[model samples]
Target: MGVSSGGPGTGLLDRRVERGAVDRVLDRARAGNSAVLVVHGEPGIGKTVVLDYAVRRASASDLRVVRASGVESELELAYAALHQLCVPFIGPRLEQLPRPQRAALAVAFGLREGPAPDRFLVGLAVLSLLAAAAEDQPLACVVDDAQWLDRASVQCLVFAARRLLAEPIALIFAVRGPGGDPRGVRQLRALPDP
Candidate 1:
């Protein structure tokens, strides 16, 4: 089977079945509602493809998109995934964060020196940063291969995902599954090709 361009009559096998879910996420962001979508499937089952589609659609709709892929080799490094997601948003607005939150993120990113940060504090800081960015435009945070994320980054992301109410943000995680489900996030399972 070949991947389609997510359009009709293109003589391609579009991921029509998955489009609705992606649309719902985009719709929610456009309406200033926060949403978290977890796309789970085994390796080679198009989880990355679906994420790519969502990224394209989001960009076309003018949403600010940030993406991070968990590297198995970096699993032992603290805050690596979270740092990747924050890089684009890490300018002067970061200074607007509460002092503690700012310090925590700076320390995590190695942009400052400090004792270890509280994990929950780092999560809240991230949520605040994303919310601030979305104030100018809707924002989408996409993560692929989430199962390989460091424990610290995963904990922070999961905390932010659970508490994203009333923000114009969408959090999408695509994980290789049949295992490795992140608790408390909505799951969108990709159906196998017939």
Candidate 2:
């Protein structure tokens, strides 16, 4: 019937396996568990369509869905995709982070002026921001075209994805081609499959 119920998705062509994986990830998050999945394939092979399926299922299940698609032009801009993904959770939820994490994100997002924030701290800030968002409801993040994400943003996302545990969060990403964003796609691929 829905992601909450682990039901099959509709209207996808020859993609039952992918849809099921997406549903299972969402189901885990709905059950107060952390889940992540990376969907990668060649261009025009329905990677974005699969991501869209996950987003629609998440919305239908009432999970708080936040989304961003990586843009080629923004690849050089630090944390550009991350800024898009975190916009919804950035305000009051940001205040909940440890001071160091707060400052790191503030500087990363250009909200504050300072020396470049440590990548490690910025990653922790991202994790904290997302976990806090999930406190109110399960959070589903749909990041499409991940191959185009800035290196800085990809690094932070990889860190956050790996650290998720016992949290109602689902981090789903779709990338085009054999691989996308070397640092992000490679690290994400390295995660214990599932």
Candidate whose lDDT is highest: 1
Candidate with top TM-score is 1
lDDT of 2: 0.84
Each candidate structure's TM-score, on Cα atoms with residue i matched to residue i, is 0.92, 0.86
lDDT of 1 by residue, 18-100 (tens): 76788798889889999888888888888888898889889989989999999999999999999999999998988999998
**lDDT (C-alpha) at residue 188 in model 2:** 29
User: CA shift at 141, candidate 1, in angstroms?
Assistant: 0.8
The C-alpha RMSD of each candidate to the native structure, in angstroms, is 2.2, 5.5
Q: Spell out the clash pairs found in candidate 1.
A: none
39 Cα displacement, candidate 1 (Å) = 0.5
